[model samples]
Target: MANVTFTSPRMQRDLTVYAVAGDTHTLLSVAKKNKVPLESDCENGECGSCLIQVSVLSGKAPVGMALTEKEKTVLRYAGKITQAQIDDAETNDRPPPWRLACQFIVRHEDILVTF
Candidate 1:
């Protein structure tokens, strides 16, 4: 298991990372573990409601794979995240391919900031 870090006004500190971690677990888990005050309107990845800037710090991000049509569009307009910045599993639409925090997954180390 790898360590996941989240830094922001509400939360700061790294927590144990797990695959398939839901939105509530993503923030609530981090907050509970790190003693932070983070809130989630919806647990699911939608509304862009829990949008945050996830600054991943791992060079091992799975990339080079083809992207879905939706992913292609998001990759085109990515601000800090690019198509090359995503991993293969993270490319799937189920958990979301990236763009929103409530969606994207962080396999590598991260310094996520809440916006």
Candidate 2:
């Protein structure tokens, strides 16, 4: 299980929800299930409206998840992540701070998400 905490200025308080690791559910789905007000224009990775900042809270090295091609293009175009960051994520297994909630899969590690 993973604890995903969401924080946003639009919300009254922070919300934390549990997500099963390797469940193949996106973070956006988890947020929607929990009634978290994460704004998303498109459920797919094509849009960057669901972009969010994720921080690892497990006090351990974060396990990197492969980013989709759409995510790479969208994030890069939005100036949320650079090519160097993407390369680091792919090569060093280090995830970038910004990610598309629709494309992010929750791992066993706890994380804090900010929009």
Candidate 3:
């Protein structure tokens, strides 16, 4: 299982939810299921409206995962992540902080997501 903590200062509340590990569901799907108010236009990975900063709360690495090729492309185009950051992530074995919620899959890691 994975614990997902979502925080929005503008909303004045924080939400915590659980998800099955290794599911095909993306973070945006989980948020929608739980009624978390995440702004998203295109649920696909093309739009940057669902972009959020992901932080691993309990894991060996901050991101604890690598970006998917689609995520890399969308995030790079949205200017949420840079090529230099991608190179650094490759060298350091961690994902970039910013990610598209539509593309981020929950693994067996606890994550704190901020938007």
Q: On residues 38-107, what C-alpha lDDT tens digit does candidate 2 reach at each position?
A: 9999889998999999999989988998999999999999999999999999999999999999999999
Q: Compared with the true structure, what per-residue lDDT tens digits does model 1 show for residues 39-90?
A: 5566454334445544444554432223344433543465535544444335
Clashes of each: 0, 0, 0
List pairs with backbone clashes in candidate 2. Answer: none
Give lDDT per model, in order.
Answer: 0.43, 0.95, 0.86
What TM-score would candidate 3 get against the native?
Answer: 0.86
Consecutive 10-residue window with the lowest summed lDDT within model 2: 58-67
Give residue 55's lDDT in candidate 1 (0 to 100): 45
Alpha-carbon lDDT of model 1: 0.43
Q: Locate the minimum summed-lDDT window of 10 residues in model 3.
A: 59-68
Name the candidate that leads on lDDT.
2
RMSD of each: 6.6, 0.6, 1.9
Scored against the true structure, residue 28 in model 3 reaches a CA lDDT of 96
What TM-score would each prediction reach against the true structure?
Answer: 0.42, 0.98, 0.86
Cα miss at 63, model 1 (Å)? 5.0
